[model samples]
Target: MAVHKVSLDEFEEIEYSIIAIHTPLEDYRLAYTLNLILELNLSRSAKDILIDIKEGKSFFSKYTFYDCKKDITWHLIQNKNEVTQRNNKKKATLFFDQNLEIPAQTYLLPELKKADFFLKIEACHNNFNVTKTVAKMNTIATINMVYSVKTETIKSKNNLIF
Candidate 1:
């Protein structure tokens, strides 16, 4: 058998079909109740979203959610969404490229806006299936991240800050 070596860059195009997600338990409650969700490029689905949270894998990614405190609205969770229902039935969705600013009011890890992410991401959504619009969810992932922080940029005011 001939031996071959694969380089790290080769995996850059790879994406996980599924992944596990996590966040500070308290944060999840607040975000969920507020009807805030993470913004993402999503494909449509048929039927109500039927995923097992106990399965430990979801579509959460590392993206910052902006102005959530200002944008939180009950309408997001109120259901009866004609747009969402249509998309799910049609099986097609448009790409939304913009992202919200990180919410600054959270007491939890306020300094970290986006979860440090490193993965082959296709796109993820949190739509009516999960109880809120996908646009308000935040990614605080805990699984399928195979790389480490190899380097971080340092800024100097006189040399120190984490």
Candidate 2:
């Protein structure tokens, strides 16, 4: 009789790049701007990234573009989703009782809460110039700032698998 065991190293890991974007423009507008500037055809995905939270499920907008020529896939996703939660406890006033709705924000990466959005670049067996891409994104007037984020420091890395 023989026994065999598999090691984690046997599995191939997906290598990707992360770029944090701080912008005031909405997701659609930002996607359009990126399309025009970066020559990418980013379109909204049919299904959004949903995360289960204590309050409720938070849906984050996702835009995707795949460059077949370069073998690179680009994903622009909203890092924050504001969910409105209704308070079950009713407030009694002089006139009547009222249910208050409070707005709660959920972040994909809690450590990077300040980042409005995150651009994920996944290149398979191809060289991608992240610095040049970041430079180009910085040219956009609507974007306040653009910078690279080290994936090693991300505690909630699983949240980005989608």
Candidate 3:
């Protein structure tokens, strides 16, 4: 008898494209604008992408749209999640102890910290034209900038899968 082996690397492969978006508009407004211009029915997901932090859990806004015809799923995720942590330990004061609140920010992809948002497109087929899509996204006035992100170079690329 001969033994056969399979590699998990083959199973881990995922086909997806990431578009980095820089915009000052709020996540909801941005999603609405993209929906109108791109003809996408993006809606807020019931559960947001959450990450556990030293203080607590931080949530990032995420909107999703699925094109059944194209067999593609679109995810619009906010890169930065702002969280406030309070300092429980109080220093001795003259009267009362003051509780200080510290603000912190967590990024989905720490390597691309400057990007305000990321549009991830996952497809089983290879018919999606990323360049053309980026071009269309650039036409939106609300979007300050839009460009395709090379997934190969991302250190935290696995985070985008969810």
Candidate 4:
């Protein structure tokens, strides 16, 4: 896996080079890959970080903030279609495969601004609050300091669950 580091404005953006892997296939390590990328990019502390996942659909199974102590904000953009927001303080992780059994907490709205896809995921006590909307070929999810908090874990993992 190759890593590309670039700084934009006051935010730091990191793009991980990954081989395109189609969905519904085993041996998919997108979760682990994302974890590694986050770890590498997070080495330098910053107020905000943007991770652009434009390569392809990534399957992330775990996301932990054990080493992160700062109140960092993460903006995750996927395929320039979907986006997920998360605070560094809240230990966040994701787990899912082709057969997505987890229900979508947020759906993309059409009234909002047009984008590929944006989905915001804010880690709370137990569950994560999700907000999503779709426009054109994009889906958008936004989360700020004001969003309802839910109580659910992505993979039933102990690291993220309190």
Candidate 5:
């Protein structure tokens, strides 16, 4: 419930009931800030972390998560690009487009909320199965990450696709 502005130096010793990180910098600053938070030994006591990166201009801390054993929730509102498979394409290619950064933002929230240790990983592939697998390994509790895919939108009728 408590929110505060934290600098790189202050992050190491911050003792707030709930830490809310709103960093506008990207990459180095973001990595340093997140690293500071993860390195802290207050995972068991912290709760409800809100990170705002909507205005972030750099991509420094794009793939890192805090390591804490608290009920943490992140409210990330940003726009980013994703790589998806193209229909009828034989080779792997990435198409860059602007889209809501929901997958990366909410991917680990549930696990972090129930975990005592922070689980930091790179990109959360746009697959619910991958998210669930990572969550299972990180949290102590049983939580499910599910999403529904429309059958009509799928180009391939392969049932073994995972």
Candidate 6:
């Protein structure tokens, strides 16, 4: 599977899509990842895409929805990028809280601004690299920063989940 940008040609092929919204406020940052994933899961093809990417494939931005599957079993883990505001601008980061049930390739990437991205790899349940823990927040197990697209066009190849 791969992440590609959706073009005008494949509008009909898109089964489902998630658009992320990030707001940098004074006290804490807000991300609409949960809303997006929830919407995506509601689509007809979301399940298929999620299952495929669990193998850890590679996807690009800007593509079509004809590239997905229909056997997604796992849910999009909690948003990892949700962070509190800090005085240092450089310290701010959007992290995806990866879980043991989810695969590696089927994980979340950075905020998408334009274009699309895809992954095709199965991450291990015990992956313990680049983890982050917040006070009352779920611990982030892995970090897979993908691409960002400007247009609403999103193309997913596969996904990671139970």
RMSD of every prediction: 21.1, 2.0, 2.6, 20.7, 20.4, 19.0
TM-score of each: 0.19, 0.92, 0.90, 0.18, 0.18, 0.18
Number of backbone-clashing residue pairs for each candidate, in the order shown:
8, 0, 0, 25, 4, 48
The local distance difference test score of model 6 is: 0.27
The runs of at least 3 residues in candidate 3 whose Cα sits more than 4 Å from the true structure, single-residue gaps closed, are: 1-6, 9-12
lDDT of 3 by residue, 1-162 (tens): 999899887686768999999999999999999998888999999989977768778888899999998889999999998889888888768988788888988888999999999999998989789999999999998888999999889998666766
Model 5 ranges off by over 4 Å:
1-21, 40-61, 65-162
lDDT for 79 (candidate 6): 23
Candidate 3 vs 4: which has more lDDT: 3
| Tens-digit lDDT string for candidate 6 (1-162) | 999898898664322223232222211111123223222231123222222232444332221222135332222222222222223223334774332333232224433332122212222333412122111112112222332223244233232222
The numbered model that scores best in lDDT is 2
Position 150, candidate 3: lDDT = 90
Residue 158 accuracy (lDDT) in model 5: 31
True-vs-predicted CA distance for residue 84, candidate 5, Å: 17
lDDT of 4 by residue, 46-161 (tens): 32223223332323222223224433323232221233433224433485323322222221222222222222332223232123211210211121112222223223112221
Estimate every model's Cα lDDT from 0 to 1.
0.25, 0.94, 0.90, 0.26, 0.29, 0.27
* Model 2 per-residue lDDT at 135: 96
Off by over 4 Å in 1: 13-25, 37-162
> Whole-model lDDT for model 4 versus the true structure?
0.26
For model 1, residues 1-162, the per-residue Cα lDDT tens digits are 999999988875311121112333332343343332343322222222222232222222122232343332121111011111112233333854343332212111212223322211222322223322222233334222222211232121111110
Relative to the unseen true structure, what is the C-alpha lDDT of residue 94 in candidate 4, on a scale of 0 to 100? 81
lDDT of 5 by residue, 1-162 (tens): 999887788654311111112223433443344344334222221233223333322221123234344423221211222223223424434865444432232212222232212222222232224345333323322222212223344342231111
Once model 6 is optimally superposed onto the true structure by TM-score, how far is the C-alpha of residue 113 displaced, in angstroms?
Answer: 9.0
